[model samples]
Target: MSTSPRLKTQDTKARDAEYQALWQACDRASRKQEYLCSHHEAKRIILESACHGILDKRRGQGKIMCGTSIVSMVHLHLQRDVNSRLLAEARMSRFPSPPPNDMPCLANPVANAGNPVGYNDIPQQQQQPQRVSPMISAAEMALRNEVTSLRQDVSLLRQEHELVVSSLQILTERVAKLEGRQAVLEAYPNQGIEGRNAWMLVKPMSPRSQTQGRDEDMVNKAADF
Candidate 1:
C-alpha cells in the first residue's frame, strides 16, 4: 500500500475511535441520534476529505465519505425511529390487552326467528386463527428502506429551506423599516441635525463644508439602502 493511503487509513481509524462513544449512544438512542453535527465541523471534515481525494462525488453514491468520519450528509433518522418504536413498545407493554368483546351477532337467523343467517353473524374472529402479517421479499424490503431514507433526507432539507426563508423574510422586514426611516431623513433636509444650531457645538463647520457633508452622508446612506 502507498504511504499516503496508509497514513489516511490510520487517520480514519483515529477519527472513528473518537466517535466510538457516539456510535455506542446511537446503539440505544436515549432521545435522538447524535450523528448530525454542526456545519463548521462538517465543512472542516469535508474539505480535509477532499484534500485527501476521498470526496468522490463524480459517481452516484450513498455518501461522499461512507467509511470515514466525514459524514456530513448522513442523517440517522432510522436510529431515532427505532428508538421511538422501542419506547412505544415499552409503553404498550405496561398496558394489558383489551379482551375480545362478546358482542351479540345481531344478524344471526335466531335473532329474527326465521331470518336468514348473514355472513356477518358468523364468529369469524374466533373461528379463523389470527392471520400472520404479510411477509415482504428481500427486494421489496430493500426498496422500502431506500424510500424511507429518501423521505427522511427530503424532510431534513425542507426544514432547512423553511428556516433560511424565515430568516430572509425577517431581514427584509428590518431593512424595509430602516429604509422607511431613512426616507423621512431624505424628505426633509431642514429637519436634519447637521443644519441645527446644536450641530455647531459638535462640529463648527463652514456653511459650504456643512452642506457638502450632508450631501455626502445622504449619498452614503442611499448607497447602503
Candidate 2:
C-alpha cells in the first residue's frame, strides 16, 4: 500500500519532466521562427532600397531601365529557393516512415480480424475434463465457512478477554483491601483474639458500654484459654 503511492509520485515526476522538455523545445522553435521573420523583413527592405537607387540613376541617364523589375524577379527567385531548401531540410529531418501506430487492434494480429493469419483460425488444444468429488467440494466449502465463523468468534473472544481482564483487576483491588485489613489486624497480637470474639459473640450491648465490655471479656477469655 505504501509503495503504491511512491510509484505514483515517480510516474508523476517522469511525466512532468517530459512535458517540461517538450515545452522548452516548442519555445526554442518559436524563437527561431521570430528571428527568421525579422531577418527576412530586414533583407527585403535593404534590397528594395538598393533597387530604387539603381532605377533612379538609370532614369537620370535618360535610358529605359528594368532595374526594379529585375530586382523583384531576383527577390522572388531567392525567396523560392530559400523556401525549397527549408522544405527539403524539414523532410530530411523527419522519420523516413511514420511512427508505428500503437492502436491495439492494429498492432495485435491475434485480435485483429483484418489479419488472415490471426489466432482465430488456429486450432486450440482440447482440455481434459477435471474430475472432482462432490463430497470433497462440499467439505471444502464448509471448512471455509467454518474458518470465517471462527475469525468472527475470535474477534468476539478478544473483546470478552478484555472485559474479563478488567473484572480481574477490580477483584484484585478488593483482595488487596482485604489483605491490608488482615495485615493491620495481625500487627497487634492482643487485637487478634478480641477481633474474632467480637464477631462471634451474639449478645447486644449499649453503644456506650460496648468497647469496655469487649475488652474485659477479651481479657477474661485470654486468661482462661
Candidate 3:
C-alpha cells in the first residue's frame, strides 16, 4: 500500500530534479550568453550548451536542439533574472549613501567576536547591491507543484483501490451465484439438498461470513468436548 505513494513521491523528486536542471540550465544560459543583443537564438544556443555543451563546440552545434522551446525557457529565465536584479537595484537606490568622510553605521557597534571592524561589519544599506537569487522562489513553486501532483496521484490511487474493493465485492457475489449453478449442474441427477449444501460449502464466503460453516464437524466436536 505504501509502495504506491512512495513510488509517486520518488517520481515527484525526479520531476523536481528535472525542473531544477532546466532552471539551472536557464541560469547558466543567462550568464554565458554569447551575444549581447538579447537575441533569442543566442540565448537558446547558450542554454543548449549547458545541457549538451560537454561535447566539443562543433559537435554540439551539429546536434539539433528544439530551439524554439529553448528560447522560450531562456527568455523567461533571463526576464526573471533581470527583474530580480532591477528590484534589488531599485531597493538599493532607495537609500542615500553616506558621505565619504561620514562614519559608517554598524549594526554591532562593538566587536563582540574580537573581529576588526571593516566593510564586512557595515550594515546592509552600506553594502554593495547583491543579485537576489530567484531560485528560492522557483524551488518553492516547484515544491508546491510536486505536492499538488502527489496529491493527484494519491487521490487517483485511492479511488482505484476503492473501485477494486467494490469490484471484488460485486464479483464475489456474481461468482457465488454462478458457481452454485455450476455445482448443481455438475451434480445433475443429485441436484437437490445435498448438491446445494456442497455448493454452499465450497463456494467463496464474504468477509462477514468468514466461512462460518467450514470445518463444522471439527468445531462441533470441539464444542462438545
Candidate 1 TM-score, true structure as reference: 0.32
Per-candidate TM equals 0.32, 0.23, 0.28
Badly placed stretches (over 4 Å) of model 2 are 1-141, 189-225
At residue 210, candidate 3 shows an lDDT of 43
lDDT of 3: 0.58
lDDT of each: 0.51, 0.54, 0.58
Which pairs of residues have clashing backbones in candidate 1? none
lDDT for model 1 comes to: 0.51
Model number with the top TM-score: 1
What does candidate 2's lDDT look like per residue over 143-224, in tens digits? 5655655676799899999999999999999999999999997664342235646555444344434556568788778899
Mind giving the per-residue lDDT tens digits that candidate 1 earns over 1-225? 467988789777756653453343332221211222224345334334442343343223433233444342223434354476587567545544455666655565565655465424335354444444455553564465556656767998999999999999999999999999999976654532545554444443356556455687887788999
Cα RMSD of predicted structure 3: 21.4
Ranking 1 against 2 by lDDT, winner: 2
Question: Ranking by TM-score, best first?
Answer: 1, 3, 2
Q: Candidate 3, after superposition: displacement of residue 125 in Å?
A: 19
Which 10 residues in a row give candidate 1 its minimum summed lDDT? 28-37
Point out where model 1 deviates above 4 Å.
1-134, 191-225
In the predicted model 2, the residue pairs found to clash are none
Q: Which ten contiguous residues of candidate 3 have the minimum total lDDT?
A: 63-72
